[model samples]
Target: MQPCVLTSTGGAPVAARFHAPPGAVRGAVVIGGAMGVKQDYYAHFAQWLSEQGYLVASFDYRGMGDSQRGSLRRLRADLFDWTDDFDTVIAEALARSGGAPLYLIGHSLGAQLPGLLKHRDRVDGLLSVAAGSGYWRDNAPQLRRMVLYFWHVLVPVATRLFGYFPGRKLRKVGDLPAGVVMQWRRWCMNPRYHVGAEGAPVREKFEAARFPVVALSITDDELMTERGTQVLVDCYANAPRRVERIAPADVQARRIGHFGFFRDQFQSSLWQRALTQLQAFRSPGETRDPADGISSRVAPGLLTAH
Candidate 1:
């Protein structure tokens, strides 16, 4: 793993890390993180993907984790800037890919906003984990229980008081720029989510996306529900997609929440599952989409945690 810094299109610094295999490279992966998550949080997964002969890149959005330089108020970024950051990371991964198939492994907000990418055509596929539309009405039971207060009272009051959302200190969401929190709150409150709130242009972007997607939805996800996940995936109307709704028992685990899939303990199970699904997309040299098949290669071991 090598630490690096990337410059966003907006000319802001973005923190990132790159992982490469020792031998032949079969594919490339860009791991777009959940909101407030750092690029370092995915180090283990990136290392494992590299071991599988993939060129893996992970990055932090501005005002989150290592990308946040000094003060939150000093940062001028919203979700749009973060999408630009993701685009920058993807571009780097694609350049280093050397014609190998490049996939985006997006988590939560990471997946939701890919429609905004200017270079979506360059990506081969997307692996969405616990990603959702963030419509409060369709959120997971836990989030739905408190959605009103979070959107109406807390987010507004907190952002105004601090000039930023101190999610890390509050233990609500993670820390975020005030613009990000406000814009995100608007998305959550709207029944149609970001697309509905942002208007026709955003919807057109989603409609324009054509890359195949593998959406992994966790039944035990504390924030995203099956409906929410599907809603987000459905936004990519022209894209061929396979949505896997998995409960803990389905993978022979005690519990796999929204965040648990990234834990090292599930490396052999969920991680390998992701690898197989991405492999099914297309290998290094070939270009066209394969059978969209994942089950034949998903081993029996996936049913048991060894």
Candidate 2:
């Protein structure tokens, strides 16, 4: 893993980690981190992809993780600015890919924002995990009530008082910048999610993104609901896409929630499920560990869409 700095459109230094393949590069992959999740969290996964022959890059958003310089309250970046930062990484991946296919592996918020990026055209494919619309009403049944309490009370009160959301201390979505939290709260409150919240300009961008997409929505994911996933994927009206709904039982796991797909246990199961889908478009070396002797449990004809 090589550490480097990515200069954001706003000129902030966003720290990044690059993993180079041991042999030939199969492709270049840029990981888009979820809301408030540090880039370091994706370290193992990125390295694993590199070993599978893809050049991978993972980085922090300007106001979070290693990129968060100075006081959070003083930092004036929003979700849109994060889009620009993600674009820099995407552009870099494309440049270094040497004409190999480029894919965006986005998780949750990372999945939702790719269409908004300036370099959306550079992406060869999008592989979204636990991707969904975050409108509180469409949240998973278990999260609906709690998210309401968060949006109606906690978000307004906390952001107003602290000038930024102290999510790290509160243990919600991790520490988030004021603009990010405020704007996200607005989206969560709106029925159409970012589409309705941001109006037609944003809607047009989603409509304009033309690529093949595959979204893996976990049935047991506590935060992302089926309806939310459908609505979010449907926004990419022009893309050829698939939404595969997988249950914990389907993968022989007791529980695979919103964040569990990245845990090391899924490397032969969920991780291979992802790589298999991408490999359909680009030729990648076999990454399975025969020692584990585990093949992909995501059987064919498991609720895929064209």
Candidate 3:
């Protein structure tokens, strides 16, 4: 892995790492992370993809992880700002791909922001893992009470007193910029999440997105539920998509939670499934839409162990 720094359109410095394969590269991929999660958390997965012969890149958004160079109290960033970061990373990936297909592997919040990308159409395909709308009501029943406390109580109190959400101290996700936390809170409080929060402009962008997408929803995820995942899939109205609701048993595992799918332990199982989807983009004569058909409904039996 090689360290790299990218500058967003707004001039914020974004820290990133690039992994190149030993042999000829098949394609280029940019791994988009969940909110508050650092890019280093994905280093192992990026390396694994590199070993698979793809040039992979992972980056940290400004005010988070290695990108945060100054005081958190003075930092200001929102969802759109992070999207600009992704754009920069995507542009870099495309430039280095030598005309190979460029793909996105977005996790959670990472997956949701691609609709806002100015170059969304240039992407060959997208792989969304545990991606969903963050409306508290749409979350898992086991997490709804905590979600309510987070949005109604914790976020307001923390951001007001600290100028940022003290998520690290609170043991909730990770530390987040005040603007990002507040804007996300506004979206989660609404049933429509980002689509409802940002309104018509974002919705129109989602409608215009024509890239093929594979959304993987974990059955045992304590954060995002089936409805949450579907809400995000529904936003891409014009895109051909396949929704896979994967159970731990499918991979012969006991539990694969929202974050477990990316862990090294599931490399042979869940991670390989993601690679299959990425490889599909490079398959000979493959069209944007799959030859079979596209369905938004959950395909529980589609994925099997290698």
lDDT of 2 by residue, 110-147 (tens): 99999898877766678999989999889988788688
What root-mean-square deviation over C-alphas does model 1 reach? 5.7
Candidate 1 clashing pairs, residues 3+ apart or interchain: none
What would the TM-scores of all predictions be? Answer: 0.92, 0.91, 0.92
lDDT of 3 by residue, 82-155 (tens): 89999999988877767667789999999999999987977777899998999999999989867787888899
Best by lDDT: 3
Candidate 3 C-alpha error for residue 143, in Å:
0.9
For each candidate, the alpha-carbon lDDT, in order, equals 0.83, 0.83, 0.85
Clashes per prediction?
0, 0, 0
RMSD of each: 5.7, 6.3, 5.2
Model 1 C-alpha lDDT per residue in residues 1-306, reported as the tens digit of each score: 877888997788888888998887777789999987877779999999899999999988986777878999877788888899999888887667666667889999889988889978767778999998898889877777788998899899988999899887899878899989999988987878988999999899988987777799998999888888888888887777768888999778999998999999889899999989888776344453323312112222222211
Superposition error at 82 for model 1 (Å): 0.5
